[model samples]
Target chain A: MYKGYVVDKALLDKDPHFKAGCILCHAGNDGELSKEKAHLRMLKKPSDNLRSCGVCHKKTAANYAKSLHYTTIGQRTGVMPRFSEAELKTFDEKVFEKSCRSCHASCGDCHVKGAPVGGISIGLVAKHKFVKKDEGKTCAFCHGGRVYPEYTGDYGGAPDVHYQKGMLCMDCHKKAEFHGDGTAYKSKNEVPQRPACKSCHPQGKEAKKETQVAHSLHDGKVSCYGCHSGSAYRNCNDCHGGHAAAGPGMILGRSPRDRKVLTTLRLIPTVRDTFAPAGIKMEHFDAVPNYWDTPAHNIKKRTERTRKCDVCHVDRKNFLTKETLIKNGAKANEELIFVPKAIAR
Target chain B: MKNRRTFLLAFLAVWILALYGAAVFAATPNKCIQCHTNDALMKSLHKPPVLPKSEGEG
Candidate 1:
C-alpha cells in the first residue's frame, strides 16, 4: 500500500532481495494490510545503516569503509597540518568526525541515493532501483565541482576528447576500482586499479616517439598537464566550505605530494585558518601549505602551450610568478612560489 | 429494412473510428513506463539485468 514500495513483478519473482520481501533490507510493517500500518518504520536508504549491505557485501563493505570517499583523509591531511598539537587533538576527537567526515559517502550514496555535496542531498538516484553505474548521477554529483565538469566540457573549454568518443567513466574506471578489490587505499595513487594515460595510450603505440622526445626535454620535471592541458581551467583560491567563486585560467606550480618540480597548477583551498569555527583558536594556523599534485582533467591532444616549445621556454608571463601570485592572492602559498623559473629550467 | 441497414452502417463506421483512435493513443507509450520498464536502456548502461537477492543470488 506504500506508494514508494511499488514492487516489480519480474523483480519479485527473480531477484533474491525481493524474494525475501522488502522487509529484509527495508524494515517496515509489511505484514499489515492497512496502508498506515504497512508504511510504519520504512527505511528509505537502507545502505546508510550498512546493516543490510554488510550482511551481503561484507568484503566490499570492509574495503569501502576505508576508502578515500569514506575517510576524506586528503582533506584531513590538508587541514590538520596547520593545526597545533593540541588543536589537532581537539579536531581529531571532536570536530573531525562531524564537520569533515560528514562529507563522506555511505554505500547508499552512489548506488541507490544521491550524495550530500555543496551542502545538499539529492533524492533517490533511480526511484529506489539499485543501479550498477550512473556516471552523470553518481560520480559527477560528488566530483561535480571540478573533475566531472571538466571531463564533459561543462566547466568550459572543449570536453576531454575521450568523452567526445562516447567513453563514459566506467569505460576506463573498471568495476574493481569502484568495488575496492579489498584494498584500503589512502589516496587514489595507491589504488592498484587506478588508471594512467599510459595504461590506454602506451608511449610507443598511441603516443608517438616524437612526443616522447619532446617529453624527455622536460626531463620528467613537468607533468603532462603542464603542456597538454588546453585552454583555461576553473580554479578557486579562498574556498570557505562550499562557497568558493571560480574563474577559468591556468597556473604552474611544484607539487607537494609527488615533488614534481614543474606541474600544471590549480588553486589550493582549505589553506591555513580555513573552516576553523568561531571559538576554536589555532596556534600554528599557517604551518602547512596545501598545494596539491593535481591531475587537472581539462585535457586535449594539443594545447596552446604545447603547440610551440618557445611558448613555454621563452614566455615568463604564463608561468606562476610573484606578480601572478600576488594578483591571485596566493602570495602566502610559499610551497608553490619556490619552483625554479621556466626560462632557467 | 432500408432504415435498418442505414443505422447498422452508421454504427459500423463509428465503431471503426473508435478502434482507430484507440490504436493511435496506444502507439505512444507512457513516459514513465518507457523508462521504468525499458530493458534495452538498463542493459546498455550495465545496470543489473536482474536485481540480486539478499543472499548474493542475483
Candidate 2:
C-alpha cells in the first residue's frame, strides 16, 4: 500500500522474514555511521566452498591459482571468482574468473542439481538444476565475443538458434561429441566420435543426402571428421601423423582388435554400469541411463531407429569385407603400434 | 656383351654405395659424438620437434 520512499516500515513489518533483514547478502549499520567499511567488507566475503568440491578439485584450483583471478582478487582484493575463465579478462586467469564466473554465481546465487541416489523432494526446489544454464548464460550474457568476434550483425552473435532458446554451450560446440573428462584430446583416443550430421538435417537418415566429402576410396582409414573439425583444415601431417607428412597419419582410433567387421560400423562398450560415475567412457551427452555402447557410425538408417552403415557406405554393390579392405591399402597395423617409423627423418 | 658387362658393374657399384650409406646414417651415438663434439643437434632433438622453417619465419 506504501507507494513512495520512506513510508514502508509499518507495511513490510507484518512479515517475519522481510522485517528481519536490511539486505539479502549484506547486513550492518546505517551508512552515516562507520565510514565505507560496510561496503568494503561486503566485497571481501569468501565464497562458500562445497564440503566435497576440494576433495576432487585441486588440479583445477592449481591452474586457477596461477590464473589472474587468484593472483588479484583471491590474494589482493580477496574475492573468489564465481564462474569460469571464459567471462572477463579471459586472456589471463584473474580477470576471467572475476568478470565471468564470479559475476554469474555470486550475484546469481545458488544452484541445484539432480542427486545421484536421492529422489527429488519438495525440500530440493531451492537449488534449481541450473549450473550449466548459469555457465552458458555467463558466456553469452555480456562479453560473448572471445568465441564469436563477429557479434555485430543479426545473422551472427552466438548463433541465433541459441539466444534464449534454452540452448547451451554444449548444444553447438559439441552436442553429439562426448565431453569425457571434458576434453576430447587427452582421453584414451579409442573410438573417435563419428561426428553426427544431426543439426544439418533431422536426426539420422530422413536426413537429406547432403554432399560432404567424395572420397575416391571407401577405405576404412578415411572418416568425415578426420578432415573437418576446425575453422580451417591443416595438412594431414598435423593430425594423423606428426607435423611431417612423411609418415602415415596416426590412426588413434581403436576398433575392436579381435573382430573381423569391415568398415561399416563398430562399438566399444564402456565397462562401467550406467548408474556409476564412470558410466560413460566416451562422455556422450545424450547418455541413455543404462546403455553402455559407444556407437561409432559409418551410417544411419532410413527410419533412423538403427544408426548403421548405409549413411556413408551406400554403394551396396561394393561392400568390402575386412580382409578385402586391407588388401585395398588400409594399413596392416594401424593401432599406432610403431613410433611413427622414427618420423622418416 | 661389352655393354652388358658395363651395366652389371655400374649396378654393383651403386648397390655397394647405397648399402654403406645406410649403415653410416644409422651410426650409434658414440660414433656420432666423435665428429659432433659440440652436441648442438643432439641437444635440439630433445625439445619438441619443430619443422625446419624456411628463412624469414619464426
At residue A30, candidate 1 shows an lDDT of 54
Tens digits of per-residue lDDT for model 2 on A1-345? 001001223333453423333333234322323235434444211223321223345554334333332233322111112112232222235333432233222212222221111111121112212243343333333323223221212222222223345544455444123222222232222314423444454323432443222232222453332222111111111111122221211121222332222222211121222112212222221221111112221111221212323422342322223432222121322331211112121
Candidate 1 per-residue lDDT, tens place, A281-328, comes to: 555554544456667777788877766766766764357666666332
Query: Model 2, A203: alpha-carbon shift in Å?
Result: 7.5
Best by TM-score, which number? Answer: 1
Scored by DockQ, the top model is: 1
Candidate 2: stretches off by over 4 Å: A1-35, A43-137, A141-146, A150-206, A209-345, B1-58
For model 1, the stretches where C-alpha displacement exceeds 4 angstroms are A1-10, A32-36, A118-122, A181-183, A206-209, A241-243, A326-332, A338-345, B1-58
Clash statistics: count for each candidate: 2, 12
Return the clash pairs for model 1, or none.
Answer: A16-B53, A17-B53
**TM-scores, each model vs. reference:** 0.75, 0.25
